[model samples]
Target: MEIKAIITGCTGMVGEGVLHECLQHPDVKEILVINRKPCGITHPKLKEIIHNNFYDLLPVATQLHGYNAGYFCLGVSSVGMKEDAYAHVTYDLTMEVANTLAALNPEMTFCYVSGSGTDSTGRGRSMWARVKGKTENGLLKLPFRAVFMFRPAYMHPTKGMQHTQKYYKTLSWMYPFFRKFFPQYVSTLAELGQAMINVTIYGYPKKVLEVKDIVAAAAITGK
Candidate 1:
């Protein structure tokens, strides 16, 4: 069966990689992208919905149905932001999108690109981790056919650039070295994209897949 997909954060590094993978797949017939700004890419199968605020999507909630999968990749760095401001972006914005999509398409598979070391225990001191964990938990609670939280560490991209991810970008270049020394904490962007597409296409029995599991799944699928 042909699959239709919705992608948030299409301008980001990982998001762009996933977008490329989805477009390349013959199984994916259409890809709807929602972002604050334009992704600047034009394709016959791609639909870009430019919205200044996520809350504005409520009016078009009914139009979001029938998608086979959704990739929620939108996120912001916690640097220089207050706790409430950070939470609003990391937790509130995510929940808003998840809830809207869940209501519109209960049977859709939701795949979230979460980072490593997310504190599922909401009581953790790290505000970012806690917010991520909360968002992950909330997404799982929704009525989707399947919900997957992909916690990837040191994602090395195949293309594009993320100037903000300076440290990770540098580490990405040294991925070969990092993999040799600490294979457990790293995964390539192509691998991560492949794994997410596989999960959305084939589905997983579990609710969450940590960094190691994501890498393992990616390796298995890539081969």
Candidate 2:
């Protein structure tokens, strides 16, 4: 199945990596990126939108149509943020955008970038985990054709990408060791991006993907 995907968070590490793959993949014919600012990249298949507020996408709703897939990578860290503030960005904003997308394209395949320790039960002790879990649960209730939650732990940065996180670059050499010893928790950005595409094209048995599932999906060439 060919893909016309709507991607968010192109300025961040994961989003940038996914956008890179989408632009190069033959199966992906068109790409749309919605961000507050320009991502400073150009491609024949790419279209960008600069919308400051994601809390409401009504202003850009007309621009988003005929997209069968969505890659939601927009997120913020909870390290120093209060619960309300974190939820506003992580949960509230995401849901608002997702709800609009669901209404616009019910058949779209939705992929969310959730961390490794998300609690599906939403009863976990960690604040961020619980919030993420709640978000995941809410997303599953939507009417999209398929919904997938990716739980990646240690991600190796993709080379030649401008938005690769500095911390990831610092530990790039250790990825080989992590891949050899703790394979379950380690994955490359390339694999994660490809895995999402594969899952969207060819539905997987499991909806939630760990590192191993992601790697296996990336290996699949045909839908």
Candidate 3:
């Protein structure tokens, strides 16, 4: 089967990593990227759509209708954002995309890049965690054929750096040491991306997948 996908946050580290893997997969026929700025990469199977705001999706909703999968990686750090601003990014923006996509392609598989320690309970004291939890819950409510919430911790990436990437870089350097002792809490960006693609291509047994599960799945898929 040829898989058609839509990827948001294509310029981000994890997003770029996943995009690379998508291009390498024989099953993938096309990848549509929606972002605020250009990714500057060109490929016959790739389409880049630039938009200033996510709300602009309303006008192009039809173009997003036929994708087989959606990898939603767009997110922001909650450290500096006000509560409303953080919620807008974590919950509002996510729900907007998921709802729109669900309406357009009810059969699409949706995968989200979520973090560990996310409080699925809406009443959690941690604001960001709660917002992410709410977003995850709301996305699950949508009528997609498959919906998965991926919770990864200390993701080790081979390239790219943002403020958080530096921290992960430190972890990546020490991964060999940690893997020998505590292998449960860490996962590579390659594994994370591959695991997500596998879940979308195959079928995930659960709605939420933790770090250990993701690593195991990635290994089985030889990714």
* Over 4 Å off, model 1: 160-164, 220-223
Model 2 per-residue lDDT tens digits across residues 1-223: 8999999999999999999899989999999999999999999999999999999899999999899999999988899988788888899999999999999999999999999999888777898998898899889899999999988889999889998888899999999999999999999999999999999998888888888888988898773
C-alpha TM-score for every candidate: 0.92, 0.98, 0.92
lDDT of 2 at 136: 90
Compared with the true structure, the alpha-carbon lDDT of candidate 3 equals: 0.83
Best by TM-score: 2
Judging by lDDT, tell me the better candidate of 1 and 2. 2
Which one wins on lDDT? 2
Full-model lDDT for every candidate: 0.81, 0.92, 0.83
TM-score of structure candidate 1: 0.92
**Candidate 1 weakest lDDT stretch, 10 residues:** 160-169
After superposition on all C-alphas, the RMSD of every candidate to the true structure, in Å, is 2.1, 0.9, 2.2
Assess candidate 3 and give its TM-score to the true structure: 0.92
